[model samples]
Target: MTVDEVVSRSDLSISSAHEENLRAGPQASRLGVLRRSFQREVHLDAGHVLAERGEAIEKANLVIDGFLLHTLHDGPKRAIVGVSLPGDIVGLSAFGIGSMGHSVVTAGPASVRQLEFPLFEELSARMPSIVLQMASLEAAVQRQWIANCQRLTAPQHIAHLFCEWRHRLARSNGMKQVVRTPFSQTDLGDMCGISAIHANRAVANLRNAGLAEIRRGDLYTSDWTELEKCARFDPSYLRAVRT
Candidate 1:
């Protein structure tokens, strides 16, 4: 499906995420100006490959809506290295790197503002805050990978991801303790380093233990404090502000 198809199927709130981004902060004005410079706004359907590993980095993308998977692909094997949420700039690391480090694939319907490499460099020099914010996002992605790979168990990884998504989506939606996920169990498995069957079991265990619950693609946790403990989660990794 195209972007129009996705919007038609959604809550008819296609511009909700875009509006939120364009009005977010004092920096939004400058960002908006920069965005207006770019002519292409891409709407990707699920399973679309936004970027491939080792491909020449020609442009970067700012996600206005939906999610994407950053995968490290080797032969036929692929492991999800990160997830690009709304407000994320996909392929930012490729700015000076010449080639993409990982493959970026759309997980659901998504819209992105594509910025050419020259324009991206210009923006970095002209708008330092934008650069800083992008750096912060890169740090967050690295931290998440560390947390998922080295710090947390499979179940803990699942809970921690849910918590992170809640915080991220809540930043824009203002809905606490509830996150509408477009990711399926297979996607969750890729993100959490497990099989789909294992991910299902982990979700079941969380539900059975009263730690988290999922209904109709929405995740909810009645007790965040307890869930945090269970997941060994730290919100600091999710912070976008410069330290």
Candidate 2:
């Protein structure tokens, strides 16, 4: 559906986490001002490409639900640079840019609000704090991508990915430890830069170790401490500005 159509729809969903952030902060009034101009929410089916690489990112997106995988292509080689969870803003880097550096595709059935660049600029003009938050978020995402691509081993990457999701989902969903992930083994592989078969093996290993288990389309960790140790996870990359 078109942006205008989605905006007009009364049933359009908003990310509760995002709304809370905007409404609870010191810059609440400024954020609220910008939020009022937010565009309509759009729903995407799994595997749908929300924006393609090399195309100009006319708008930035606020994810309301599900995950978005950012994939970068180098000739025939494809690498997943990042995953956008609910309450995360995708394409912030493309703001004031020429084109998208990577293609964003839905990891599952997803919902997002598309904020056009012009409106984003307006938001920034009204409240620079929001822009700072976006910048901080983008930096955090890039740091994680660097670690996943260059520092972590295959198994460590998978474990770290899950741990990161747990923390993110917790912050967004009443600070819960269990994360509801709808991704398949292939999606896990993409995020971890491993093969689907390898992802399955890694998961099996984790399950055997009593660190994690996937049940009913959700991922639950029996012992987060052990899981973090197994992943060698460091939480510094996911921190946002406290203000």
Candidate 3:
């Protein structure tokens, strides 16, 4: 999708995630400047690598319409560390760094607005609030991922992942009972640190409990409150900062 297309989409409240932080008061006008500064829009198919681990960072990408999987590689083994959704920045760490610590690839067909490193640096210098907002978001995402892998049980882990995604989608787009996703059972397992078979069973448990179900490529939840309880989810960490 082009920048104009993304801004015009009624489903998206702003052109970029950072823009959301600057939406109110006088900072609102900076949104237009930020949008125009974006270099270009690039589209990728599923499994396409956006950045390789330890590779020099040339630009940062703002996710426009799909998911990006963040993974860590060690020899032959790999672990899914995080997933970047719509309105999320994929390579913000590149701002003051030369290389990405992990590999990032498209989980499905996705589009991103590329901000060249020099331009990103310039923007960051001019608008310190953007850096602050991005840093806050990055920290929250990391803390949530750590909790998901360490504290939650298999079923709870899976449920929490769904709940988090649902909350995030609601923020970027709009709230809905059914969340459209591109992640498969294997992908879900990777995110939750479980095998595909274990992930299947966990999903079954959620379905049996009338909490949630992953059918096809969508997550259907009947009872939001119950599902939140099942996942032990607290949405505060994922809440947008309104000023």
- Candidates in order have lDDT scores of 0.73, 0.73, 0.76
Candidate 1 Cα outliers beyond 4 Å, as residue runs: 1-39, 215-217, 240-243
Q: What does candidate 2's lDDT look like per residue over 1-243, in tens digits? A: 433443333123445544575568757544544444456689899999988988887877888889888898778666777888877777777766767888999887999987777656655665677778767866786777676668877666777887888877765586667778777887777777788898888888878878788664467876788878988887777665531
Tens-place lDDT per residue, model 3, 1-243, is 443443345225445644554565445445445544554789999999999989998887878889899998668666899888877776776656788988999988999988776656666677678666766877787888887788888889988888888888885688888888888888888888778899899889988888888896688877888988988999888755421
Candidate 3 ranges with C-alpha deviation above 4 Å: 1-23, 27-32, 240-243
TM-score of each: 0.80, 0.81, 0.86
| Worst 10 contiguous positions by lDDT, candidate 3 | 2-11
Relative to the true structure, candidate 3 reaches a TM of 0.86
lDDT of 1 by residue, 72-110 (tens): 866766688887877677777776687888899988798
Q: Can you list the residue pairs that collide in candidate 2?
A: none
| Model 2 bad stretches (over 4 Å) | 1-25, 32-36, 215-217
Clashes of 3: 0
lDDT of 2: 0.73
